[model samples]
Target chain A: MISIRNLTKRFDGNTVWENVNLEIQKGETVVIIGGSGGGKSTLLRCINRLVEPDSGEVVIDGVNILSPGTDINAVRRKMGMVYQHFNLFSHLSVLENIILAPMKVAGRSREDAVAEAKQLLARVGMAGRENTNPADLSGGQKQRVASARTLAMHPEIILFDEPTSALDPTMVDEVESVIRSLSEDGITGVIVTHDLQFARRIATRVVFLADKGICEEGTPEQLFDHPTKLQTQRFLYRSRMFEQDLSPETLDLYALASELRAFLRRYEHERKQEKLLPVLCDELLYPVLKHPEAPAAGASLRLLCSETSSRHTMMIGFRGIDSDPLEEPYLDELNLALLNNYAEFVLSRKKDDGWEVCIQM
Target chain B: MTIQKTLQGSALTVAPEGRLDTITSPQLESELRADMNSVTDLVFDLANLTYISSAGLRVLLSAQKAMNKKGTMVLRNVKPEIMEIFEITGFSSILTIE
Candidate 1:
């Protein structure tokens, strides 16, 4: 459905990428992955003329979208873009955000746009939040609303630029799941992201950009598991190690605690900081373990550790605990003080069958 | 878990040892209930107590609530581990700890 021929881009006499060629088929989900400053996002922008390429053509259907006389706004209307920071209109409510483009640009009636917007909001799991302001919503909720706004346009192709990059670790899954569901519905999508796990989940084809051009392109399994290029191998291996560092398998309470201690020590050593693990364990995990309702054995607790560009986080999930561990009623002044002193941010949410407590530092 | 109780004058002290879990919290509750009527000061010596669950917390809450009307309740020698439980669950403010 889309083809790029000899596409090149440069900034301040520096070549970002050159001679990039790729063919994207209808209903295909493609992901562009590369190291920082590789112009993965710049290439995505080049598709809709959001970033004008120095050379070459981006053809959708049969016409070159980059042609001088072509209608850029009309072309952009057919393509939806979801941004890293959500890019929601700060002044608009969720419903207004979704309905504005369709009503203003597409000439749809207000009632019609609103009806469609409600359906899109429900589809993205934001049914009752339509009246809420963007500032009032969480990062995850804003992203979902941004997606619904994009879908409200009813575009032929959607572009996602690191959509979950700005989200907290707990919020990443909800947004990823929404995007995954959209892919399942056969929406053609091109996403640029650093999240290897999310890239693997939604991609039908993967493209790696390095050294000012397209370095490799293959199925996700081929690119991630057995890349032929050295650059691809190195990138994938390093990201895989980082992911592994965060996800230790489920273990008994004692074993999990010990492993967390070791993990914290390693983290502190690597970052050259004082150890925060003992305090975390003392204030968080120990209480859960000693709580009479705690599960006795076997996958009772799960630990997820993630390090993004801006934050290092650990999420400890407790299953089979009947009460909410982080409920406001249960938090005393000391609990709040201890959490504030030890972590950058603390959030708790109830999952389908368990409670997840996330501590970010 | 095992419970040892001693009554001296108007004060009653109970020391519990081992895990205070769902299976054992009821034992502590019944023990507290049996002697709470005559006592004006309830003291828990938790030095030997190793663990506590929500069920144990419920018992403590009930004891604290009962003591609120006529008596004073204090927890002494709480291990660091047990102290953490109180902090996490917000029980530290509700129950006096020494």
Candidate 2:
């Protein structure tokens, strides 16, 4: 529930955003895309008043957030922000960093804040790291703690300002995973970033801050493949976007594609090396088919399903094998539903040639 | 689900193998959403995917929004059948699938 109208910003004579108008619906994540100096981050700052714009208005859930006299601290608290630099307080324990803001700014009790901090820390992938100091933590761990700290504030909207900019390629995934979880909770977001790949894969709509200010907006595909402006296209081709007057935002897509290619290439190798099916010992093949999540479709799967005396197996070779494991529980639930719906038709197979037609348990 | 991120500079690439559905959408969400600052292009190669549902669709929507802010997100080599599902559900309209 955020809206921006004719928003503009400039430092000296250089303009970051000009006549930038945008809207973000509740639970809808809107990404602002542009190169460095395009004012992507400035746009977000304007919303929270982190960087006051020269002109234009920011409306949050119908409240004109950019108005003078608005509560800046309150506005800041409502939008949890995760910075790229992993802004955890070095002196404090991980737990304190998360609890401090919420307890102080939100006026939450120490006990309650701590309890919530613990839950959030775990959610942000630092379950066992609460007592650790930032100096002792890994880059990924540090960023997660920062995210937990942001969550502590219980903001209505979360703003990500290139949260992974400082991370190594490998370490970025862990942090990325945390943000992904935040969106599913239906937290409204305004992510100002130059990482088009991240936005493409994770965002719902992409907004561009360019040609003066929040200039163009569209889906990731529209901006990347058929950008409305040459500047947008140039930034896209370089995979680097930035603005000197505003916060810099941009990255490299080609390098990312190569990395992905290499990783997926490795997957192919692993797939080739991996055993296609698990051999079930002593049992019949038909019986295993009763498992609803069973692959049911590969050549190997077909062979097992067609064979009469097949036995002992691992749940492998299914197409869903590539699916994210976070869905495991839901898959389990779906399996249960299948069991409930077709209990009678579904049966364990005999060690040979047929189904166990009469077994009750 | 295990997702490995291979990055060069600001660009980030993720290889997630395993179902990306309601349960696992969280992991995909976690793994892909953070690169908003450093990554400009995103590609999801679904050559291994065998199952996809609306839950998966929602994650794609979220990612698209995230990337839309900066660059672009493309789904490449989606299985023909999975592509059919996208077509059937009209997700093809909202997402940029290659």
Deviation in angstroms for A208 in model 1? 2.0
Query: What are the per-residue Cα lDDT tens digits for candidate 2 across A174-280?
Result: 87777778778888877866556677866778887667765567877786678887767766675111111111022222232233234323322232111111101
Candidate 2 residue-wise lDDT at A328: 47
What DockQ does each candidate score versus the true complex, computed on alpha carbons?
A: 0.05, 0.02
Which candidate gets the maximum TM-score versus the true structure? 1
Q: How many residue pairs clash in each candidate?
A: 3, 66
Best DockQ goes to which candidate? 1
Fraction of the true interface contacts (Cα pairs closer than 8 Å across chains) found in each model: 0.00, 0.00
Tens digits of lDDT, candidate 1, B1-98: 88999999879999999977555778999999899999999999999998776667779999999999998999999998789768876788888998
